[model samples]
Target: MTAKVSYLISKPVVTINKGTHSIDAAKKMAEHNIGSLIIMDNEKLIGIITERDIIRALGKGISLDLPVEEIGTTKNLITINENDSIYKAAELMAKNNIRHLIVTNNDGKLVGIISIRDLIRESHVLKALSVTSEQEWIGSD
Candidate 1:
């Protein structure tokens, strides 16, 4: 059985306003033990800032005091519905070279986020189940 994106998204999605400082955002991420934050603007999902974005901004000499919007990925915000298969999410991530994906409800509202780590965990679970099933079959007369 294929797992859905809903199975991977963490609850009560962590979000930050677009005007939030990069340093502050990083602090929030650390406090929450998360890698990314959904960027909001006027009660709308505008973009996302991830650890990778922060690293890139620092490497480029961008000021951490600047708003996260200035360094965040705004264009082409990749998203998938909550019911979409995890395989599809994996494909989207691989194609976009992104470690995270925003999940939206049917009404097009931000619901949650999924990370590559979540996908890897799900893959491991599936693989273990497959191995167990195969072993059972082999052992059966």
Candidate 2:
């Protein structure tokens, strides 16, 4: 059975509006202990600004005082529905080489987020189980 995205997306999301400054986004990122925030406007999922975006903006000498829309990846967005499978969500991340994904509702409102680290943590648990299983098999044999 495919794991549902509802089990993976981070809830009670921290979001930013297009009018918000890059500095504000960075501050929220740190305060929320998250690497990215879903950008919204009028309760609609718009864009996303990640830690990498903030760093790249700084590298280009862009002012933090500028709006997040100035630095956010607005050109190509990848969003997933709430009921999608975890495998599909992971596939999207692998294909896009992104660590985070925006979770949207039927109306495309920002709902939550999922991260590559979340998937990695799951993989780690499975690896531990696999190791234990192998150990038991060896001992029994």
Candidate 3:
């Protein structure tokens, strides 16, 4: 069976308000040990913040004390449905040059989040599952 984005979901997607200080966003990411944080406003998913965003801000000498959005948080968030194929998720990420993705439900509500690392890990599982045994391998000397 082909894997789906739902299979890659890590529960309880972390989030932050757009107005939160950039430094606070960084700290929140560190606390969660996550690379990105979803940005929600009025119970609506808006955008996302990542370590790279913070890095860019620092490189530009932007104050970490400023609102995270001021750091130019990703305005266009690329999302995938939880039931969508994992291959689709990977394709979107590669096409967009992004490392993270938000998983939404049928109602377009945040269900979870997935990262490139998750896809890589899932790929290994798929590979292992594909090779049931060495005898099943297609290659031969």
Model 1, position 101, has a per-residue lDDT of 95
Clashes of 3: 0
- lDDT for residue 20 in candidate 2, whole number 0-100: 93
lDDT of 3 by residue, 1-141 (tens): 777899988657899987888899999999989998888786988888899889988998888998866774556668999998888887799799989999999999989899989888886445644564455565663
Best by TM-score: 1
Question: Over the full model, what C-alpha lDDT does candidate 1 score relative to the true structure?
Answer: 0.89
| lDDT, candidates in the order shown | 0.89, 0.82, 0.83
Scored against the true structure, residue 93 in model 2 reaches a CA lDDT of: 90
Error of 2 at 57 (Å): 0.8
Off by over 4 Å in 1: 124-141
Candidates 1 and 3: which is better by TM-score? 1
Ranking by lDDT: 1, 3, 2
lDDT of 1 by residue, 1-141 (tens): 667889997557899998899999999999999999999997899999999999998999989998988888888889999998887887799799999999999999998998988888886446755776799999996
Per-residue alpha-carbon lDDT of candidate 2 for residues 38-76, written as tens digits (9 for 90 to 100)? 777767677899999999989999899988878887768
Which candidate number maximizes lDDT? Answer: 1
